[model samples]
Target chain A: MKRVTLFVGHYGSGKSNLAVNYALMLRSCGKPAALADMDIVNPYFRSADSARELEDAGVRVIALPFANTNVDLPALPSAIYGLVESRSEYAVLDVGGDDRGALALGRFVPYILEENDYEVLYVVNFYRPLTGNANDALEVMREIETAAGIRCTGIVNDSNLGGETAPSDIEATVPLARELAALSGLPLVFTAYDARLPRPDVPGPFPLTLQRRPV
Target chain B: MGNKVLMKGNEAIAEAAIRSGCRHYLGYPITPQTELAAYMAKRMPKIGGVFLQAESEIAAINMVYGVAATGRRVMTSSSSPGISLKQEGISYIAGSDLPCLIVNVQRGGPGLGGIQPSQSDYFQATKGGGHGDYHLIVVAPSSVQEMAQLTGLAFDLAEKYRMPAMLLADGTVGQMMEPVELPDEKDVEFTEKDWAVTGTKMQRPHHIVNSLYLVPDELERKNFERFERYRRIQETEARYESFLMDDAEICVVAFGIAARVSKNAVLAARAEGLKVGMIRPITLWPFPSQALKEAADRVKGFVSVELSMGQMIEDIKLAISCRKPVELVNRAGGMIMSPDEVLAGIRKMNGGDNQ
Candidate 1:
């Protein structure tokens, strides 16, 4: 596993959910884990929303300075530098949505590329409106890469309809995920699904618990 | 749920607007409603439509007015403060009888309040926010699916009535993701507007689109004609949903996110043997008044749940002619009411206030 991991892709594509889960999983496995939230495009449903839970479980949460504030200023916290510079063994950075969102991640591109031990997983869901097919999904993935100035290492198929997702729904997206992986030349790293549902047949099943929203 | 796609409420409205044959979109960035413009920016140019990120909310709305005059479907969206800026344009559009969709994904505010979900704009939306006499056919969507479906309906109703229409949403619904089956693109058809100010090309008399009348009697007659259209809309277009109301004695009226929260309270109250039901108004302007009026006879009392200081309660009172006491269950300043608070409000209706 890479020391520095990033989750980026289309909006509403479950990037924050996967980032939070990956950090928690690393913490649960007794590794020194730190989570950084770099999203500025959305005001709600942020990984920072679960800062308390992440902090309580021994995972260092470098949350947004303006987490619960009303203002929509694109204020990036200085603490975000810890995502690349922190002494934690595993650092998971949750980038914002799409190309506009990936622009925030570009600042760390040189440092991350120099480190050369990082992984940028392009997390995608075929069920999201903008990226329903492999061709459309590839275009978005390329847009994110260009905007972020980094190439994707792998693909995570986090495809399912929220609350209405069944095992069949998870299974239905496998072919689309494979097609995206083939087109983008990125390996199929894993397929994420709701942990409550029984794990369906997919390569590298990464069961996920939904993110806790801010109270 | 056929071939369902997951989408945020803001994005859903954008896609559904495009599918509804709206080719011109003008909006400025504002939280909770920013994604709507972002989606339009990405999709509009690819489809040969006009998508402008105007310098100001006022500018965007006036551009919407320009597009509407040419008899093409047009829209502009903003949050609370931005919506306030567009009020004058909305009134102008209504006065001119030009059809357009103006969306307000509301946040807390008297002036630049928090970017959290709020229904505080109820009074501004239902009553006239702009000057003079007019109503923008307003609709409130509780879920992302309705956000998509109602966007299409809003454009249809605006064209049919030849006035401005609004989708009154809040931050919660505007930001939440839900599975939705969008309308097929092939079905979107735009009808001809004989009243449009399209250039004559030396063919016939020019059709003028204007709200200004130099004479008082002429302006008065225009106002009367607009009111007649409003009267017909009020009679024929009031839509709402009734939940667990057939056997309930205590009626709860809410809309948008508050209504979604109230539904859970209604379910929990029903489980505890409390005869509580909910009336969710789909149309806030043509406010499903007859439903509440009908429910008033059977229901013992009413509870109006909201994210504002009881704005919708005013409509509830008028809808039922104040025959029953309408208590308020609300939280203001960007706070959301939980199911427990709403259940407590329901309990008060049951007996807490009796003795």
Candidate 2:
């Protein structure tokens, strides 16, 4: 596993949910994990919404004050710097949605790039209307990469139709994900799906607990 | 071909509005409806549609009036306080007998309130937000898919009736994600606009579009004519979903995000051996009152589940004509009622232990 894992993608591409599950997965595997919510654009459902869950599992959570609030306080705390600098901790940064959101990750690029131990995972959803196809997904990915000032090392297919998601839905996105991987010249890392359901019949599937705040 | 894609509720509404041939989108940004405007800002320019970020909500609604006068599909969206800013323009649109769509993804408010979800704008939508002797066709959607579907429906109804239509939603439905199949552009059929102010080329009489009638008699005639159309709508357009209501003893009335929560609550209450069911109103203006009136005959009582402080409760009571007792289950100022809370309301209405 890479020392630093950053998830970046189009909005509603399931980045935050996967990021929360990833941190929990890392901690369960007896690894020191930390998650930093960099989503300043979205008003709700950031990785920080699952802060209490991550903390309960012995994973460190870093987010701006009023992270889950309706207030659009786009301030990032200095605690996020500690996440990247710590050599012993496995850092997972949930970069906000789309190019607009990726702009927030700009200032941290130099530190992340120079370390040479980071893997920026460009999360793509084939079921999202705007970035549904491979070409559109690549264009969004390029824009996000430009805005964040970093290159994506791998592609994570995190496609699903929200609550109505079926295993077939995840399977149907395989070709699109592969095409995205081919066009972007990045390796297809994993396909994410709800872990509570039966495992999807796909290779390198990453099952997630589907992180959401208890309503 | 149906392509069901995952979409946030706000984005779904925007996409469906475009698919419904809405060519002009003018709006000022306000959460949690900001994504709807942002989606239009990105997609409209690419599709040969106009997406203008007006100076303010007032400016946006006036721009909507401009496009609407030209007999083209136009819309503007905002949250609660922002909607309040557009009321003057909305009243003007209604007074002029123009067709357009106004979307309110409601947030809690008497004022700025908060950005979180609230259905406090129910009275503002159905009763009197725009000060006038008129009604704007109001529809509320429970799911993300419904958000898209109802956007198309609202535009069609607005044009058909030559009136303004409001898609009254809340932050929960507007910001949440779900699998949705957006309406196809080819499938949307807009009504002809013979009353529009299109250029006559001096060969025919020019069409004049104005809301002003200095003569009281003329204004009163317009008001009477508009109410006649509203009567037809109230008779024919009231839409609602009856969930497990056939054998229900307790009918729960709700809409938008509240209906979704109430659905789960009704299901849970049923599982607990309570004869509770749900009536989710889709059209808030021509509210499914007659259906509730009919339900009142069979059901012993009614429960109104809402995110507001009992705004819709009054509507339910009036609908059933006080035929049966009606109780309220609500939370205000960005708070939402849980399925458990709604189930408790159902049980309490049932007099506990499955009365």
Candidate 3:
């Protein structure tokens, strides 16, 4: 199968929950997306949480081995291998948060990108470490590249992590993201938020925010 | 749409990441994997993506942690030394049970060894690269096409297990050039906000992503829970590809580029009326031990071929458990085993045994 999307970011930047929502969004659109877990760095809140829920929603959840200690043995499932070799379209992988987690990509990126056709997105939140400024963000990118062995292709301005985040914050980070884009010669692909937005006119890339209506 | 282009294994991976919907790429420069970063630098922006050349292997992996926290499909690739720097982050990701893809287009070493492809990381991946108790889902690609295909699978499996997945490649696979078909872009669909903390909306609370469990019992519980997931993963992710094993007297086991060369040797041997078969491992972590054990029972002996001195050969021996004599045919420090070299080893083994 082909057409898999990977979600990556630094620790505490909120990629797991984002992965779940994004997978759900794709599912709502009548697409059969699969969620694969490749986060081998951080210690919590992974895509495995919604496995049954995603499976119930017709999204296949790639399962991982459980951990008894912080260092529990990694137990990868067989279907995972099958999926890597499968013919399905639209698989979503939620990578671990941090440059070290990114190191896991050392071997497969060549194969996945070439044979199956996948994409890698660097989720940049201005509030996090090494991404606090244009230079810091660039530094983070460099670190990720060092770990992954590939340069980042673009930036995602996901500049919020709860606690009274505002539209202005996202707006401010947009320029930084753009600046990073310019420096790296990569496009600021898209920006995302958990709340509603005013939809700014500064448009070179797509901006998306997560705002669910009240029940 | 046909984009059948000739490219080196490294650059090919960079291009494939874009097609696979990988938008965030991070990594530092390392031999064998450098072309991948150079390629991402030129291509990521043209299609709206982020390509960053990180400061160090440690920082790169931490950045991956940040971006991955946002629940995006991101990747980082490196060689052996760079991979070593990422071990701490890898341990954390495993403890936390996050899903991400790590590629190691391996080069030699214990420490800054050399710039040659080596399978020395076999134990690191299967046995756990860091100090903690975690196992990565390691996939070993023997060819350029497999490099791309396994990357896609690595993402899927990572998500499934909430664990780190590795694409274990060698310098030969990374530096070599080959013709490959890129995946179509029209098929990908992303829904990253489901569990990602894009700042808690008015509807939910803030999300916390970490690997630290300060409370002893709680941490213990978390560890056990993670083990449960790994247990399930083991039942599912073991993979291997076999060739001409049905009536063969000798079976060879190998992975990554070595397997490709061994396949050729097996064919050459078969042409000479020698009953030989080759077993190629696609996933090195959940090793196909059973398959090797079965082959050991049926074959007169097993030969493990690798670019390293004798890394994966140990696994073969452990799996076969002295059922049959397991021989080693290796080329270390940047040297590759030519078909003739491997065949020679096989012939010598046959002669020695027969005598």
Best prediction by TM-score: 1
* Ordering by TM-score: 1, 2, 3
What tens-digit string does per-residue lDDT give for candidate 3 at B49-140?
89888889898888887777777778899999999999998898777677778889888787887766788877887789898778899999
List lDDT for all candidates, in order: 0.90, 0.89, 0.73
Q: Write the per-residue lDDT of candidate 1 for residues B1-355, one digit (tens) a residue.
A: 1479999899999999998898999999998899999999989999988999999999999999999998899999999999999999999998899999999999998798888889999989989899998898999999999999899999989989999999999999999988999887845455557888878889878899898999999999999998998999999999999999999899999999999899999999999899999999999989999999999999999999999988889889998999998889999989998899999999998887522
What is each candidate's fraction of native interface contacts (fnat)? 0.77, 0.80, 0.00
Query: Candidate 2 chain A: worst 10 consecutive residues by lDDT?
Result: A64-73
lDDT of 3: 0.73
- Distance from true location, Cα of B155 in model 1, Å: 0.9
User: Model 3 - which docking category?
Assistant: incorrect
Candidate 2 stretches with Cα past 4 Å from truth are A69-72, A213-215, B187-192, B353-355
lDDT of 2 by residue, A1-215 (tens): 99899999999898999899889989999999999999888876788888898999999989878765665579988988777776679999999998999999988878887788999999988888889799999999999999999999999998888778889888888988999989999999999989876888875999988776534
Stretches of candidate 1 off by over 4 Å are A70-72, A86-88, B186-190, B353-355
Q: DockQ for the candidate 3 complex?
A: 0.01
Worst 10 residues of 1 chain B by lDDT: B184-193
Give one digit per residue, the lDDT tens place, for model 3 in A81-183: 5555574657777777667677775555664655546656777776542356777667666777788766666566776634345566557677777888898
Each prediction's TM-score versus the true structure? 0.97, 0.96, 0.61
User: Over the full model, what C-alpha lDDT does candidate 2 score relative to the true structure?
Assistant: 0.89
Q: In model 3, which regions exceed 4 Å deviation? A: A1-215, B186-188, B348-355
Using TM-score as the measure, name the better of candidate 1 and candidate 3.
Answer: 1
